[model samples]
Target chain A: MPKPSPKRKMVRFRDRAKCRFCRENVTHIDYKDTQTLQKLVTTRGKMLSRKRSGNCAGHQREAARALKRARFLSLMPYIS
Target chain B: MPKLNLSRVYEAMFLVDSGDAASWDDLVKHIANILTRNGAEIVGITRWDERKLAYTVAKRKRGTYVLAFFDLKNGLAVVEIERDCSLSEKVLRTLLLKADHFSVADMRLQLGEDIRQDVAQRLMTERGETAAVVHAVVSKPTHTGGEPVLPEPSGDYEPRHERGRRSERY
Candidate 1:
């Protein structure tokens, strides 16, 4: 009898959570709104990736732009 | 090109020392004069906020922000205004952005009675016309609700349960 084929390891992928902006129907991400932006960044003031922040591709792009603007205005810190 | 000379809306934020807040009227007039001198039409002007800086800028710990909206035909006017602001002793920093997304009504709504005396009077007389126009333009959700409410640097974004998880991991 032929040897049984070795079992291959299965890779598990987590389902993506819904983006907060999409859930709230937010169209524009205001750089002045630091409260919302704070939630999207890490403690060290680095922006979180879409997977980690639960932002959709579109909102993630806007968030990145807004965050950079906020940093320039000194409305948000560049680093903690 | 003709398109380059076409009028466009712009939003500018001016940063000044909080100490000069008393002479806000003068600063606003000064800014208005600069825009007018550059052939820009004044649409609206408002005081955004006064707050402590995240980082020291121009050796100032606190600053006051003045927001202005205008229509300008010359694109070079923006460069000229920025140059003037930098040279002025009253202004510490400035940030200007294209504001085509906003409408005249939206801009007018931000105009306070304390702004330019003539503009304020004109708005008072044309209140009905302005209100009708406001309904036509899609209103923006107000983001200038004073300063940003900063939560504690710790334990705000993270949930209570998740807070302990970090310590446990270490």
Candidate 2:
């Protein structure tokens, strides 16, 4: 039998366990609060995915809705 | 009597040219007329903001936003109000939203509150500054003759002795 190749040891970094909104206990996401929304979007004006933004599924949905509304009012750009 | 519970609250934002905002009182009344004409009760109307738009609408570079809250019994009233806004020359854009989530008190807070001052203060605080530097610039000053005069240069005005050299060069 061929000798088993050496298993690479997996190294773990600092724990990123909690979503940002969950950690802060945010109940509502306001589109008028552009500062917070800007953090959740990429530089290109595209929304970051759940995994990238670390937002819970519920907050992510709310953020998406707010972003769309903001875009319609020209509060946020549709494309950068 | 018609059902009292049929009316629902709504939030609307109207975009108008900043130049035309000088007649906001008349504009607000016009908007109220439109809403009341369609059986909508006006809760409040306020100047929301005056700012540079991210994109121009109706060839207007600067826009003044008017925020209004109202209660409407029929959903079709929204369509009629939208039609009126589109037909009106004063209004550039209009956005109507069902605001069932907002309480009457919260709606009152939004009315007549301009957030620009708050934003400026927040930015100053974020920069580790305690006070705001407000410089009021008057572009034109009315002279005693009642004609507008160009404002004096802001900095110390040292008469330019070098201005005569251009004539010598000719």
Candidate 3:
């Protein structure tokens, strides 16, 4: 992992965004739920990291796995 | 060796090609048979949605999704299931994974709404909408009421040419 530069430190703000799954009280994040997954990814079909998405470390990991599964099945684009 | 006793819940989401078939009942049954034949007890199968993909897959741009939940013993021949799905002509792609959170109640909560949405979508298309409105009209197309009437174009509707006319000048 690369060290955060001084500029990156200045950009840090308290994460106000709530984890979407926690907000929705949803425990199971299915790869087939592209509607929800789309929100977690950019138009280029890249998964947003935990910082930008405001996802907890645990849920973020799960979301990444689910998104990968969705990508593997061609349910989602590798490069939208 | 204790892995032999590990029974796990799995969810499989299949993208099916309906371009040639008039009905999906037989296809769904065939998928269920695949699960049962592989020793996975069926939990529920839900019609997730039908829509065009972001990019072409297998030379097809459109597909219908079937989300199936089942139980499988760990180390079960999941590869065989994968092989069968790949071999089947009706399936475009299949995603299988362990779903520890699925429950019997979800059968109604998920599939029940999915079935209702399917009917509503059919009705909408019958009234001259398109059959592929997976994200159109109602997000959760439940049995709300009588046939939905397409809303009239809002007053804010403006011609595209009009917007560019005043802005095109150098």
Q: lDDT of candidate 2?
A: 0.65
Off by over 4 Å in 3: A1-14, A17-26, B1-7, B113-170
lDDT digits (tens) for residues A1-80 of candidate 2 = 97654452111112247777778766667655555667766554667666556677898898899888777777677876
Arranged by TM-score, best first: 1, 2, 3
Q: What are the per-model DockQ values?
A: 0.23, 0.08, 0.12
> Candidate 2: deviation at residue B5, Å?
4.6
The clash count of every prediction, one per candidate, is 0, 0, 0
lDDT of 3 by residue, A40-60 (tens): 775556666566566787788
lDDT of each: 0.69, 0.65, 0.63
Top candidate (DockQ): 1
Candidate 1 displacement at residue B77 in angstroms:
1.3
Which candidate gets the maximum lDDT versus the true structure? 1
Candidate 3 vs. true structure, TM-score: 0.65
Alpha-carbon error at B109 in model 3, in Å? 1.9
Per-residue CA lDDT of candidate 3, range B1-170, in tens? 46555667676888887563337678778898888888876666766666666568888877776777666774457888999989888888888877555433343345654333443343344344443323211122243333323222221212223335532331
TM-score of each: 0.72, 0.66, 0.65
Query: TM-score winner among the candidates?
Result: 1
lDDT of 3 at B170: 11
Model 3 chain B poorest 10 in a row by lDDT: B151-160
- Deviation (Å) of B98 in candidate 3: 1.7
